[model samples]
Target chain A: MLTVVKNQILVCILSVKYNIMREMLNKVTFLMNVTFMILNNASILIQWFVLFRLREDIGGYTMREVMLLWGLTAASFGLSRVLFARVYSLPELIVSGKLDSYLVQPKNVLLSVMTSSTNISAIGDLLYGLILLAVCGLGVRGFLLSLLFVVTGMIILTAFALFLGSLAFWFVRVEMLSGEMVMGLISFATYPDGIFQGISRFLLYFIMPVGMIVYHPVHILVRFDAGMFFTVLGYACLLSVAATVVFYRGLRRYASSSLMEARM
Target chain B: MRRQEKNAGANVGVLGKREKYIGRRYGLPGRKYGVIYRSVLMENLQYAANIALGFFGYFVFIFIFIKLWDYIYQTPGELIAGYSKEQMIWYVMMTEMMWFGSNAGSVGRQVKTDIRGGNIAYLMNKPYHYTLYILTKYTGEWSVRLPMYALLAVMIGTMMVGPVPGFKIVAVPVMAACIILGLTINAVFKICISLLSFWIEDASPFQWLYDKLLLVVGTIFPVEIFPQALQPFFKLTPIYTVCYGPAKLIVDFRPDKCVEILAAQVLYLAAGCGLMFFVYRKGVKKLYVNGG
Candidate 1:
């Protein structure tokens, strides 16, 4: 089991490196893609700044906390895209029978398929998040905690997307549905958690799980809580397991295309 | 005698073909575009489920903002940035509806793909104007989508924030005109940006930047909410005419503001069309088709 885990990690790292090298072949376009993405991410902050101008805090979040939320959300989202970019395209792969290559591989299919692609522009997001973190004056301890939360956030996001994308197994045209679902998760995660109340709050925390992905993590970062930290970690594990089981189960239903194609 | 008659009939057929190619070119140009528009409308209606699914994202955004504003306006009848709580919620609903309803990004993406994938080679040679063809095709889609989204927005807005205060029924037609103009300006600008693909390696980043600007400046909040120093700058951009103008008019209609917004929209629409044609002409001159 340990050997398998090690192998999966090695494959993931190599896949990411290969993908990055491929994109970096065009250095100028790659740099522009990343730079523009960072600018794209930063532009949205104008709204928050405009809002904060009118009021001191939104949903009990100061400007600093909001920045932290935006930073963490961007960073985690970027990390997920950078590491598991293929997860977003899983529905397309499933629909087109492109998973045949991964199915034949000896490595873990989910991990192998996910890490086979990279979003180079997401590096911008990762950098932008760290820049925001530095701007927030995060100490070493807070920064470390934020990094931990980023991992958990990445896991939850990936798992949720995988679980949604896996639905393509049973349903036709599930790609749009899954895309919207994943988009909803990211969209909600960026908003202040305190604004949500009652059933909506419950829905965010449990049904969609943006709470576990971002809100809880940011909350814990604002004031460290060991119990919440463990809960988030546990939730991440639970979700990862759920998503993996779903994907493999769905794999049983996958119909391979008769068309032969070269991977390289 | 039979051969001569047949020859004359063939001559008439050739003349008709020549007329079609060089003369009226499928009757009135508007009618030609109308056919394209109707076909696209039919296609979108056939796949209406996909567009309907987009409402889920729309709902999430509107719901979040509703709650956010509710939190902000803690007291009853409180006004922030010249809008009451109800007006603010309605403003969000309206702007978000316009944003989601217009399907603005589709045109840009379509243009980019056509240019990059060499599909524009086929499209540019067609009888219709390429930009006009795209605008009509997407407008047909918007015609189908916008009404449905508008219905959903009204339902959600009324349900969540109870109607906008002092919303005059008489003002709705003017507001509708503003919305149509705003969406047109938006689509035109999107085309202008996408036409950049003819010059640049990638125009998607520009599209993203444009979308984020619109979202942050006008869609999420009114220009009034921005700092006084920046309001003029915001107004100078199409974000003012594209999103804020129509939404604000709907939420809070003043006759003077209505006239100002309509005039500005017309000016922007003209300017947007001028820019679109300028880019398209320049880009087409630079376009290179690699293979057959």
Candidate 2:
């Protein structure tokens, strides 16, 4: 069993490396794309920059805290996209019966699908997050804690997307719902959590769970709480398991569309 | 399945020959492009589920902005950056809806695909103005989608924050004109970016850059809120015309501001059209020179 797990990890790593290498073949273009995305994301920070310049605090968050919010969100989102890029395309895969390829392979299908590709621009997001964290005066300990939380956040986010994308098996054309959920997650994750109130707050924490993906992690990173940390860790683990179970269960309902196309 | 087969057959040159032959026979440019527009509009309308989902996504963003601004206001009548919270929220709603309503065609993505897939060669042989063909398709899609977006905006705006203050019955025609101008500016920007695919392997980066500029410069905040030093620079940007100008007028209608906005829109429209034509014509020449 341990050997099997190790083999899967090896395959995942190799696949990611291969994908990165393929993208980086044209070093100049890859660098340009990455630089453009970093600048694009940094420009978004200007909105908060102007907002903070106008007001002292927003919902109890200082500019520094807002930076942390954006930092964690960007880092986690980047990590998820880089490691589990298929999470974004799962709806298309399921609906189009592209899952047949993974099913035929003698490996963990979910992990195989998750690690199939890496987003070239997401590397920029990862670097930008670290830059923001550094600008916020994060020390080594803070950096380490952030890495841990970012990984946890990535897992939960990917799992959440999988759960949503799995709905495509049971229902036709839920791709929009999956897409909207992902967009909502990305949109809400960057904002200061305290601003959300009542039903919005509830949805943030539960239905959409942008809170679990970014807010909780940032909160724990800023001021470590044993209970909260454990809760987040547990939530990530449980959600990952639940997502996997739901996907496999739904696989039975995935009627092949016979629209298969060859991939390089 | 039959439609898919027909589409596949069309791609394999059967339908292309027929369409090309028809285009060559009929020198009626307007009718041919009109058919393209109707086809694209009908194609978009057929996907009701997709349209609803898109509206829902737009709603989610506006809903969040409303909540965020509601929290920011803190006081009932406080103004920041020369806008009361109500005006600010309304401004965001209008700008965000302008994005939804505009015919911002994914020309960049389409061009990138065409170049990467070597389909541009075939497209160049077609007997229509490629840029005009795309613009018409975009306009048709925008026309179909705009009503749905406007209805949702009004419904959501009325529910969340009530109607825009000082709105007049006459404001409708003026706003409609502004919306058309705004969409034209957006379409021109997209076409220019798409044209970049002739030179760059991935024009997507350029599109992302343009979108970010629009978001930060105009969509997220009104140009009035920009720093004094940057206000002129922001005004010089097409973003002011595309998103900020019309949205501001909707929230606070003034005859003078309306006139100024319309004049700027026309100027930007002309400039945008000129730039688009230059880029596209040059890009096509380059493509041909490179044996594309």
Candidate 3:
């Protein structure tokens, strides 16, 4: 068990390094991409700024709290994309029969597949999140707590994307639906939770579960609660396991195309 | 010699010289583009189900904004930046419809891919202008999408906030014209940005920046909401012509305002076309391709 764990970790590290090196092959473009992404993320803040000018707060969130919400969401999303970018492409891979390559490897197929690519722009997102947190005057303890929430959020998001992408095994052309689902989660996660009520709020928590990804984490960050923290962590673990089960079950339905392809 | 003479006469006698000259001079290119437009329109209609899936994102945005605005407009007839709550909601509906319906993002991405993947080289030898070909194809897609989104917008807008408080039925035609112009301006500007791929390795970031600007400045809120000093600057940008102008006209129709917006849109559309052509011409000179 220890050896397997070690091997997976090593695989993850090496995969990330290789992906980063590949992107850095064109250093100028890579740097420009990261810088532009940071600006892109920052540009949306102008909306919040415009809104706050008219109202004291939006759905009980002051400008600072909203910034925190954006920070956590951006950082977590960025980390997930940077680390497991291929999760987003899983549907295409499954549909095209490209998973044949991963199946032949001895490593954990899912982990190998997930870490096989990187989004260079997500590095900007990670940096933007940290910068926002710093600007918000996050102390060391607050920073550490935010880090834990970021990880939990990242796990939930990646697992959710994996679960959606895994549906490709059973359904042809599921990519559009899955893409919308993931985008819906990200979109809702950015908004303050106070605005949502009744059925919409229920849907967010249960059906789509943006609540687990960001809202709960933001609430805990405001005032640390042990019960909520454990619940968030537990939910992350449960969702991860559920997604893994679904992926492997769907894997059984995957038919290889006998495609001859090389991965350099 | 008799058979050859007969065949030549048969080929030459179909049209008089004047009619043939007229057809060649005026009818051919327009007919060709019209055919391209119709074919693409039919292609999109065949996949209408796939296009309808976009409503999920549209609904999510409108729903969230409705909830947020409900919190903002505390009183029954309160106004923010000179817009009553109802007008604000309707304005948001109109802008969101145009934004989603325009299909600018996909068009921009297609242009970028074509340039970077060396596909444009193949297109250069074609008789039609590349820019016009892209515009016509996208216009076909827009025609199929915008009406569906508009219907949804009206339904959601009415259901969420009741009807617009003082809307004039007579204004609908003018509003439709503004909407079409706004979408055209948006599509043209996107093509201009995508043309930057000729020099830059990636034009996506510029596209993102432009989208964000349009979203925040015009799509979500009108220029009046900005500080008084900034409104003039904001109006100067294409965001006003592309997003805010039409939505504002729809939500509050003044004849003079409509005329001003229409005039501005025409100017911007012309400028956008000029810019697109300039970039394409320059970029074509730099383009190099190897390996068929």
Candidate 4:
């Protein structure tokens, strides 16, 4: 019995080792990706430079602050693309019937969907982020705390992506919702979360949760505020739990219609 | 058997809840008889929401900019770098709408997808021009959007801080021209991006990159903020032509500058149209490469 089970495991491992093949891009894709990254970086640099004239300090943040904010933003945004861009693809997947195959899989459907498209541009965002973080100058103790903040911050971001993606099961056509969410996030993200005060700050922190995404961890690293660190880490874990519950709950009615028969 | 089917679905995760919560998001079914027209019209009627949201969003940034510029202009409190706070705000509102309205044509990339998939070949044997067919399809949709938007502009311009330019007879033509120019550039941009799907597999990144660049196309802030040395080069940029012409109206519709702006518009319209045709011809060649 043990030998038969061992043989089965070995067969599975051998097949896996062989089947994870990937194809190479034939020049155009390479050029497209490289050009897109270079141009995008150049554009952001220009905006940071131009907006510099608005103030040595913009909205109570310095030029270095702005650049670092942009850098961290690029990283966070890049990381989302690298890991969670498939969430943006939820509508198309449902419409095209691609989710059915994922539904029948033994593993979680969300995990499968996210893994399907490994985003390349996100690498650029990640690189830009690291450079920006290094420049932000958090010192040794500050840097360690900042790293902890960013890691937790990423968890909160993934939860947000999952929450938005789950809407696809109900809405079926949620392109605009996702786009509006992106715009709303961008509006809050471009400036320091400090510019917002009172109720608006509440919305940024707890309501929409972008402040947690940006300012929570940033506050520790920048010496703005440190107590928020424990709150953000705790919040991220809770949000992830809430998000998973929301997605699976949304997935239940997935009648999946007569369209994409490819899955079942 | 039915129970078995239900149980099969109930086994793993997300399936059960979607069944109960499926249709709760909207009440589109309320108008069942004209579901076809109503759905189409309802979809287009969403422009009201877009316009309202757009105005609110525009006002936020304008206030932020006003505060920023007020600090700069505090010494004189009149004008700085050829702009007053009011003029700058007006430019912000108009440019925001124009850029929004133009990029709205981005959905046309689905048209390109259809072409690449040879789904467009369905229309090839039809009697009408495919271009005209799409134009009318989109126009009928936008017609519902236009009235509400015009009203939003009127209300916001009249009630809220009020736009400097309004229903003035002479300004109407320029604004109309601006709207037309916005739609045309958007359509052409869509076609060019869509045409790329013929050669490359995905056109989405191009669409995203192009739209984001519109932020710098002198829409949110004047090109003059780019520093004195860069202004001439900024003026000559094709991107500047689409955004700046309408913006000029809000900035100051000078009789002398009208000729220049109009000339810029004519030049942009001609160039965009020319680029679309060039891309179309090349795209068609690529399509045939795949026996498509």
Candidate 5:
């Protein structure tokens, strides 16, 4: 059993390496992708900058807290996109039956599918997030804590996306619907959590859980609490397991597309 | 003898057999544009779910802004940046509606697809002008989407803040004109950017940059909210024509201001058309020279 797990781990690593090598083959295109992504991330930050310039606080969040919010969101989003980009395209994969190769492979299908490719542009997002953190001037402890948030946030976001994409198993032409829901999720994530109230706030915390992804992390970083940290960690773990179960359950329904396909 | 007669008769037609056929149906100066426009409008209606979901996403933002502005107002009749709270929310709704109505992504993407997919080669040989063809098609799609979006915005706006005060019934026609012009300006700008793919191979980054600018300069908040130093620059850019100008006119209509805004829209429209032609002309040359 240990050897089986070891072999799966090795296969996942090699798959990631192969994807990286293929992307690096076009160094200029890869660089361009990263640069533009950085620019795009910065451009979004400008909206907050404009907002903060006008007023000192929004939903009781000062500029510094807002900046932290963006930093966490960008880092988490970037990490997921860079390392497990397939989560975004899972609907297309499922609907088109591109999962056949993963099913045939000896490795764990979910991990294999998740690590099959990387988005070079997301590297820009990751770098930009680090830059924002530095700009915010985090101490060693704070920076380490932010790193913890980045990993947990990525896990939650990837799991959330997996859950959403898994719905393709039962539905037809759900690609757009899933895409819009993800956009709606990101839309809420970028804003200061203080702005949302009542049902909207409740929806963010539960249904979308965008608050868990960025808002709660920003709050925890600003003023750390053991209970909140543990809750976040527990939620991430629970969500991850739920996502895996849902995906495999849906896997039973996937029919093949009969197209010549590759993992990358 | 039969082949010679066929070849000789084909020359009498304006361009080709297909051209003669399509031209007769859409040949008239006024009717040609209408036919292409209606076809695109119908095509957009076929993707009902996609359009519905898109509006739902837009609705989320509108919901947020209504809350944000409500919190900010604090008083019954407070004004921020020359707009009352109600006007401010209405302005956001109008802007969001116009933003969605642009439908410029598909316009630019179609251009890129045509160029990259090598469809441009055959499309260029068609009887109609490629630029006008794309513009009419997109205008139809925009027209189909706009009324539904506008109606939704009005319904939501009324529900959130009641009817807009000082909203003159007469201003609706003027607002509609501005909105149509905004859609045209947006489509033209995208077509210009997409034409760059004939040289750059990937124009998406430019589109992304342009979209970000539009988001910051006008869509997120009005240009009036920006620092005074940057207001003129924002107004001069195509962003004003696409979203800011139209929405502003709807919220705060003045006959004098209308004249100025309309003139600017006209100027931008002309400039956009000019840029579209210039880029397309150069791109076609590049295509021909490179055998694309």
Candidate 6:
């Protein structure tokens, strides 16, 4: 029994190393990639700083207040890239038949493939995003409430990212399709979720869950609404399970092909 | 390393005397510059329809955001965050136009494909700075698209009920400086992304990453809307400086702050250009001439 346990650990280590290798080979951008990240991020920052400093209380938001709202939008976008950045990888995997190699691997292949290597630049985007959240968080009436919302919002975001990535199993050409959906979600996450009327709010809350990622959690923090905490927790748990089931189910449909077949 | 080629190197130094001319390999102008520029322009122009469609497609998004923002603010009939209905509406339109103006990303893929195919060495053999030549090519491309976007903006101007100009004063010199800085930053980004071709076997993932990030940081909504805690870091990031600075300057000019922003813009351009050189130098040094 002891030897068997040791063997299992060895297999796990090997699988981890293989995943790392696959990631390193793919994500390493010699020099150009670094420059691209620097330039683009700089432009984004500049736009944020300028032209957005005004305070008018039209909808119960000051200049900085709106900034805080906008900040959440940035956070959702940044987090999406950081965690589920691999969702963008699905189309190429399908077209190239690289998914075949994952099927033959020992570990939970879907997770391994999904997170071969986190986007290093996305770490910057994530940091930038959290900083935005913190800025908004500073205004919260209760510190503990803000932290709770952050945690719950993160849970919902993770589940959503997984659900999107799993869609690639059915749609081989899911790049633009997934991209558009995520962008639309970012659009939704930017605003205060409560502004939507009865049906619109319901659509966002249940149908999409994007509202829960940023606006709903934000609303909870500002007002210290107790109900949201439980509701968010329930949704996070349910969706996390759903994401796993969808990805594994998608895996069964992945048919291995060759470079020659792929080219054809 | 071949004996016959080594002995013949001295003779081929003379351009017309050699079977394949080597004159273009140095700073000297290749007679083919005009022809090369023309062909590149021609090839780019073939995709004009796609460019028009892309501009229109992105424009639709502005209206959607406008509707959404309007709905969010329906009950309260005052400015949310100092943005009047008209100013905020134009804000959406301007941001979209700003994006259309500053995109040099598509050309980045050309460099990556060339690198992957091992065809970049062919350009290295030409008599021009690769960076300058590529920038020139993209400048021509943008020149074409900028007008298309301007035309669309005019249509939006006439059709939309949003930010109409209170008056028209040409912020010419500032605008010029912004354009140059914007283009330089964009060109550098393309070069940076293209350089990844040296390390990554395929460039598709890198391209997608760049595009998505661009949508968020480079052009989308202004970063001021970000939470206060997040503002400083977003401001410091280089992308916000490049793509955001120019359009914001036009939409809302602060002459006192303009110099400082321009200075920052210049710094980013310099940094982006310098980074490209460093990358290209190292990348070429490590380059294995994979036979095409």
What is candidate 4's CA lDDT for residue A260? 48
* Candidate 3, pairs of clashing residues: none
Better of 3 and 4 by lDDT: 3
Q: Which residue pairs clash within candidate 2? A: none
Which one is best on DockQ? 1
Ordering by DockQ: 1, 3, 2, 5, 4, 6
**What is candidate 4's lDDT per residue for B69-170, written digit by digit as tens?**
544444643764577766766676667656544335534665666775787667645654455445445554555655555565455545644557332467
User: What does DockQ give for each predicted structure?
Assistant: 0.77, 0.60, 0.71, 0.13, 0.59, 0.07
CAPRI grade, predicted model 5: medium
Residue-by-residue lDDT tens digits, candidate 1, B96-123: 9988998898999999999999999999
Deviating ranges (above 4 Å) for candidate 1: A1-4, B1-25
Residue-wise C-alpha lDDT for candidate 5, range A201-232, written one tens digit per residue: 89999889797788888888888888888888
Q: lDDT per residue, candidate 6, B1-292, as tens digits?
A: 6888876786566645553444444225544455556776788688676566465345546655555566545555566655556555665665566566545665787787778878888987776667667777776677667767767875775576534545235675786577567766767876887787777665654665566565675455555555678767866776566656765665566776578778888888888889888888888876789564
Measured against the true structure, the TM-scores of the candidates, in listed sequence, are 0.94, 0.93, 0.95, 0.76, 0.91, 0.58
Scanning candidate 4 chain A in windows of ten residues, the lowest lDDT window is A15-24
Question: How much is the lDDT of residue A243 in candidate 5?
Answer: 93
lDDT per prediction?
0.89, 0.84, 0.89, 0.62, 0.84, 0.61
lDDT of 3 at B134: 90
lDDT of 6 at A19: 44
Query: After superposing candidate 4, which stretches have Cα over 4 Å from the reference?
Result: A1-27, A91-99, A135-150, A167-175, A258-264, B1-78, B104-108, B111-115, B119-160, B165-170, B193-210, B289-292
Candidate 6, DockQ to 2 decimals? 0.07
Q: Give the Cα error of residue B5 in candidate 2, in Å.
A: 36
Error of 1 at B25 (Å): 9.1
> Which predicted model would earn the best TM-score?
3
Per-residue lDDT over B87-146 for candidate 3, one digit per residue giving the tens place of the 0 to 100 score: 998888899999888778988988999998989988878878998899889989999999
Alpha-carbon deviation at B29 in model 2, angstroms: 4.1
